[model samples]
Structure formats: structure tokens, C-alpha cells
Target: MDALPDTLPDAPGERLRIASYNIRKCLGTDRRRNPERTMRVIKRTAAEIAVLQEADRRLGDRPAALTPEVIAQASDYTPLPIAKNHVSLGWHGNAILVRPWIELEDLHHLDLPSFEPRGAVAADLRRDGQLLRVVGVHLGLRTPDRLRQLGAISDWLATQTRLPTLILGDFNEWSATAPLAPLKPDFNVLAPGPSFHARLRLAPLDRIAHCDLWEPARTGMLDEGEALRASDHLPIWGEFRLPG
Candidate 1:
């Protein structure tokens, strides 16, 4: 692939690299240890915006900061999690982290069943002086559960005003028949196939999809091997540039 332009739009109408990953609660291949390893993997991905899945809250608390890198490794983001009781386990859901150059306005999370407080994170990012809506979602695992989750997200997104949007994350779908169908009219699933079960290298569970003013310069899984040998899922990254 060829190199994309260095500068991406920032004000309301610009382009950027946006990704999503299911850290599996930082569960390593060995099935032991979590936090530190998760941090390592995230630092390596180095995306401008990242939507993380399986970010469970301990004692029902989100991570520490709001920075993209901060939220990728820790549970720090805005809106300060009002409550946590949607799933059977409680306090596990999605988080969106954006780079400093980019700003997200109006952020919130949706509640889903089957998964532990499953929800979607939506934000209005400033690009090219234009506002773009980027949504991050971690849907339920079970087919039935996820079906409901998909409906909720599709319905919710329909209410938004027309704007570029990117919906990303560990969608939990292992086949080409992804639940992203309803979202097709607005945004497309930027990646090609399966991306989960990180250790086995099967399934494209983690993803980066977007719409308006952007082109996929390139995209794939991150392989750190050791620096951050944590999480059952591997990180999917993409390089995007502004559309002519």
C-alpha cells in the first residue's frame, strides 16, 4: 500500500484513524493477568481514536482519564458513567478514546442486556470545522441478545442529524453476515473479514468503519508479540486520509 497524507482534517470536516478492540478484559492467552498487558497492547496500536470492548468496571468504576491513550489502557472517558446495572455481571461495556487534536462533543452510552451493561458511545468530533458523529459499540455475544442490541443501536443512530459517522468495535460477529446491515445506508464496515480469538488469529472481531470525507489508506491487526502480550483479542488498526 502507498503512504497516505500526513495531515488529517481536524475541524468539523476532516479525516482520521479510528479503531475498535475487545480487550477481553485484558485476559492474556495464558488466561492470567490483565491490566498491565492491556496497556501494552493499546500503546502499540497508537490510534487517534479507539473504541474498546469488554472494559469491565471493578467495584463498578470506569478507568482513570479521558485521553485516547489513557482510555485505551485505562477506563478514563467523559460523561462519568452515571450507573452500571444492565448486564448480569454489571459494569462492563464500551469506551471511546480520542486524540487531543480531535475533540468529541456530546458523549453518552446506551444500555443493552445479555452483556454486562453493554452499550454504545457516541461523540461529535471537530474536523475541518465540521462536526462528525463517531459511535463506538460492543454488542452482546449471543445471537438473540445481539439482535436486540443491534436494533437498539440502529434505532438510536437514526435519530441523529446527518453527519459523517464511524461505528466501530468488537462486533462479536464471526461471519460476513454481520449485524451492521441496518447501518449500511449511513456508514460501511471498512474492514474485510473475521478478527477475533486473537491467540488463534481467527475472526475480525475488532474493526474500524467510517463515512464521509475519508478513505481507507490501509488497515489490519497489530502484532506486538511481547511488549503487550495480553488480551484474548488482537487490536485492529487503520490509516485513513481525507477523500478528494
Candidate 2:
């Protein structure tokens, strides 16, 4: 796979690429449920860690839309066991996939305050003595609920050990500032570009936010090849230089 562009020169710090995508339950914009195609788009990102929203179906048991077996066969990533049940791949459809070489130190499923069943997943990953924390979320539809969910996430993070952290997913909020204000105090939130309505590309619904320990090298949206037909929201990625 081709390497993602980086603005920074060679440095002593570790460089990591993380991506966020809303697979829409593996139902593509073409109106077909193709998990393999979704995996192909993810593989194209060449990300070390990928946080996915709507990874599982809504009704019934909320089984994984993209099965672990398929992901294992398609790429080197291994899905973290954050699901509440045996069949689901994530907690409330928020899932995280990382390279198998990365060690998982801790994991949490955060239940947010909302009228709908909304939640987020937090995972501590370690490699080569460097530790990183990632939180994957899919916020509720209403603006009020979105703010509440962000507050809930902040409350949950307040109790955890500090580390280089990244918060990513389909935020579901159209306006950039209002709903995400709660996170502004601590994180450097960035929306790479417009990724929603993948066919035409209008709104910037997907985003990545990180704390002070990491410096963003570059950020972009995957819009080529399979990405155009993969889902309604294109995958957004960011490369960050980890603290030495």
C-alpha cells in the first residue's frame, strides 16, 4: 500500500496513522451490503488504528456488520473485543481495529446520557514503550444529546490515566463548534474536510481530535476507488507524531 503523505521530516517520535469511518452497517451508497468492499476501503487507508461507527446492525442482536473473520482475512488488523455481547463487534456500534502487534492495556464501554442507545469505546494501546489511548463514538442525532454525550465522554476520561489520546468517529453534528465545545478545553479537535454524502461530499461529519501529547502531521479524507461507493460517509484519517 502507498504511504500517506506527511508534512513533518524524520523525527525521534513515533508516527501513527489513525482513521475514522462510518460504514453505515456495511450498507454501501449503492444500496448493497458488502462487508468486503468496506474492508477494502479501510485497507486502502493504511492506518495503524481505525475507529468505526455503525459497525453493527441496529435491530435484533446487533450482530457485527463486518465480521471479525472477514477483517482478519482482508487485513492485518484485529478488532478489539469491546462488544457487550458475544455476536456484536462493538459497543453500540462503535468499534476499534488495530494492528495485531499493538498491545491492548485497557478497554472501556461508556454508556452516554441520551434518549437513544448511544455509547463510546475507549482503549489503551501500547507498543515499543509508547502508550496511546483511543476513543470511538457515534453521537446521537439531536444537538442537545450530542452535547450531553460529549460531556459524558469528558467525565469518563477525567478518571483515566493520561496518555497520548485520540477521539474519533462520526460525530453526527453538522456545525463544527457548538456541539464539540465540551472537548475544546482539552483537545485540539479537527475536521479534515467534508466527508459526508460521500457521493457529492458536502458536510464534515467525521472528525479526529487529539490531546497535547501528539502533533498532527497531516489529515485527509479517503475519496478514491472503493471509498466513493463504500458508504455515505468517507473515511477521514490523520497522521500524528507521538511524544518521544
Candidate 1: tens digits of C-alpha lDDT, residues 1-244: 2332334333322336665667666667787755666655565555666667766644435542222344434532222232244321213456655555566557656666665556677777774465777777776677777667767776887787766667777777776556466566655676534455665667766666677556777776665564235777777777676656
Q: Report, for every candidate in turn, its global Cα lDDT versus the true structure.
A: 0.60, 0.86
Question: How close is every model to the real structure, measured as TM-score?
Answer: 0.74, 0.93
Best by TM-score: 2
RMSD of each: 5.2, 3.4
Error of 2 at 11 (Å): 16
Which tens-of-lDDT digit does each residue in 176-213 have in candidate 2?
A: 65448788678888898889989987788898889998
lDDT of 1 at 161: 77
